[model samples]
Target: MVKFRYFPDMKDNNIRNFCIIAHIDHGKSTLADRLLEYTGTLQAFQMKEQILDDMDLERERGITIKSHPIQILYKADHKTTYTLNLIDTPGHVDFSYEVSRSLAACEGALLLVDASQGVEAQTVSNTYLALENDLAIIPVINKVDLPGAQVESVKHQLVDLTGCEEDDIILTSAKTGKGIPELLQAIITRIPPPERDFNKAARALIFDSVFDNYRGAIPYVRVFEGRIEPGQKMKSFATRHVYEITEVGKFLFKKIPTQELKAGDVGYIVAQIKNIRDLKVGDTITTLENEAKSPLKGYKEMKPMVFSGLYPVNSDDYEELRQSIEKLQLNDASLRYEPETSEALGFGFRCGFLGLLHLEIVQERLEREFDQNLITTIPNVEYHVTDRQGNLFIVDTPSKMPDMGDIEMIEEPYVKAEIITPPEFIGNLMTLTQEKRATYVNTHYLDPSKVQLIYEIPLSEIIYDFYDKLKTVSRGYASLDYEFIGYKPSKLVKMDILINNEPVDALSLIIHQDQAYYQGRRLVQKLRSLIPRHLFEVPIQAAIGNKVIARENVKALRKNVTAKCYGGDITRKRKLLEKQKEGKKRMKQVGRVQVPQEAFLAVLQLGDEK
Candidate 1:
């Protein structure tokens, strides 16, 4: 395979590569849209709302799914000289891996916070990550034009949280382009130029990547020091794999090939690389001869936090689902998986994800891209079990549950949660938290009316539809932030489902005993709706260590099929078979038809159902 590189002759001091980081719906995409317009990089007619978030799901969901880099010419001081590479990143916690990669690629970050919401959980988490990465932070208080926007108070919160000076906060609304010019000026003045030694061997950081049909895998990189050009050989400092660049391109609104790229420029390279697994985010790429003293520290790959199985509604579409997953993984490095064989569900994948949103995004993309319907099991977190013999096993799927006697101790991860809510809801919020196996930590009054409630909760509890429920109870008035706080010993059990004395792997779950009654009943109810009316009664049971807490039955389906296939209706039997296959495909075959992802999710809505 051949490789190519870019070596630009221009000075590096005039260019800037930065990213906008914010909480979900806090206007990161909006600000990016305005920046493109302000710089004339995009014409008014060419502009679409959230254009950088080009994915249909992303645009519709209004959250960036991946980091996108775009370069524009900024004319200041009578010179159209500076090349600004703006990376718009996902703001939700599930995409923190993408956020970290974007931060690593830039010398600075624009920390956009909503003026009305103040510093949200994601805002504080992302800001702290940026600061830890040693990037120069420019705090921008957005949404100033809104009626409830409290720009001044938000500035105070920014200072209090980040230690950034209150005067450093820039008030702006990306909607009307108010203060956008000053915000651009701040980018030029506050963010430093990329520091590099051109004489040294080339070294750049792979902060983002995408798959293109024309050019296999394109890794977006920041040339921190040195230069590169087409046909030059390079190697990943961490992976020790070498490749020659086939194409080097600058992201000018769209990725455009350039003959050369110099130190401090943010662009992408199409190498002899096909699989994205080789070019990891945060990995350092450098010239073969002059490698870094050591690969950039802290380059560990992201570990998936949630696991589930994805099977096709049509058994024959299994390969198509696999292909779709491969395509999706090309762009999403945070998604991990391996071919998994299930006795009941047939061929599928034991897929891993960063969180619930990550899982949902991948599933949606699979269905959209491959045009194949899928039957997915409820997502579960991995657990570490050590037997009395000191053997350790990481249990990702409930089907892999260890023998009851072999288990000695089980450890599960916990998280520190910070919830900001109105004072009036404090009592209900406390009650809700306590019910989720949460222990109160501390509470602070942000002002006279708003309060910050801190709790230490098991990561397992928050992993499953907890945020959605939390939001529901808080009436969208609460903001939650949490980080993994290591593992703690807890009373955990595998709640198994037996269909006619046979254990159904897809129906098992790892849950705390205290929650087994509520969760078990919920799961049983979900299964009752999910399992189609089949021949004979099928029992949906949630059992903890052989003890059944809840049971529901899906009665034998009457009138599921026509009694006769009439003349000219021969096609009807075939059609019915096709429809039955399609409907059954949606139902997971866990000894029988398991309804679908929607039904599994619906079980959580029993409270609303009441």
Candidate 2:
């Protein structure tokens, strides 16, 4: 028999690796806190709101930004013990890729459904993802303490929707800790143990990773088989790079180095790996002896779904912004970038992100972490353009689009969306969706007073602040979920911006021909307000195929800099210019005015007027 290594062989069958999956605001984080409290992992005085959501942005936005894994000890019989590895995942569509990776690291999942909201689109989608991963689903109907909770009804919905037995459903309020102990027991009973062939070479999966200034890149891993110790030689399955494990440790809400880690435990490896690209989530790590045939499969690198350009508000801060991006990239592998230069905006970066929230998170982090200001371009979707001769190019920025004569076919992505809302707002919701070029697929009554409306809509239609608009139209009663279906032929035209009748290459866009008129007018109106007044009046025009669909004028500046500078005043003006330059150092200069990136983002919602 092949020698199998074991480390800290603390009871094999008493450990559980699981994640809590739920829709946004369904109390996943809260449930995690309650679990920590009940398990004595946290003292009552030490408990803070949403401790797992450690990032400031997450707490402010009331969303989980990253997947957090915590280990807790629980007891059953007089001598029985278990180590519960609880992975708390982000509850947003933008981070679904992260969710999938987190799910892959576990053998089971706790599907948390809000008792009052029942089954939402995200709930169904995440549950389906978990099922697809073959995870043992432990359905937990949470928020039962809420006044509007319909626990029994939600239990039935879980049974009907997921095909899980009604008796399998566990009613728990992560808030009041009601049914928490039972939920814990159910986890111990229902979840299966990790299967591993200790005889084989040590193999593990990296589900999470972060950059540590002191130790380099620390990858959070789950050992599938065999044992791993500090100083063990290993190679990454994806990058094919070899490294020595500098340290092996477990997360005690924070990192605590342990001597060794074994199968079924979630731990971190301090490898000399410095770059994020070297450590991929879902990539396998294995020993050289009896090396595995291949690394673990099913690891798909994340692709950026949205494109935008970021420029420093001040030319001086350009390098600072670039440095900030590099540091951010150290931790965020999902962000993609390429350096871009514009005649009007100078040097900037064409950055790509998973989605709007991902884009906003990066921007916010840059400002908060680096304390630098930037100017960002409007968010846009990628399009495939083909020339008459069949040459094809994927264009992300409208400024990079080829001339009209060079393109014959344009293709854009489309998505299938399911929106659930109250019956009273069906007409208004339908009208809003229709105006956004959504085609009705089907509608079903989820309950007597609630409805699920299915629509096949162009991804471009909803990519720009559509969720915020949907919430406004539904009065916060609607929940939406969408997935990319495929690409389709679109009558796309490049809308050009004209300042004083001269086309400004910086403000071009690719839009569908059918909606050019309204979109063009709206964009021009938005630019009129966003563009700062200069020495000359600027005429903003949106055009499609040689036709101007909308026109707006930015009136000339009435006053700008002070005309006269006396002795003390001159010093003050110099100081003011220096301060302005310092401020500009954080911003990107677009045209004459130094514009901040937040201003570019603020204009994104200009078209959502009532």
Best by lDDT: 2
TM-score, model 1 to reference: 0.88
Which segments of candidate 1 are over 4 A away from where they belong?
1-12, 525-540, 551-610
Model 2: which residue pairs collide? 312-587, 312-588, 313-587, 313-588, 314-584, 314-587, 374-597, 375-597, 376-597
All candidates: TM-score: 0.88, 0.89
lDDT of 2 by residue, 88-118 (tens): 9999988887888899889999999999988
Worst 10 residues of 1 by lDDT: 1-10
Cα RMSD for candidates in order = 7.5, 7.8
For all candidates, the clash counts are: 16, 9
TM-score of 2: 0.89
Tens digits of per-residue lDDT, candidate 1, 457-507, equal 987778766787778888997888887778888888888876544566766
| Candidate 2 runs further than 4 Å off | 1-8, 529-537, 553-603
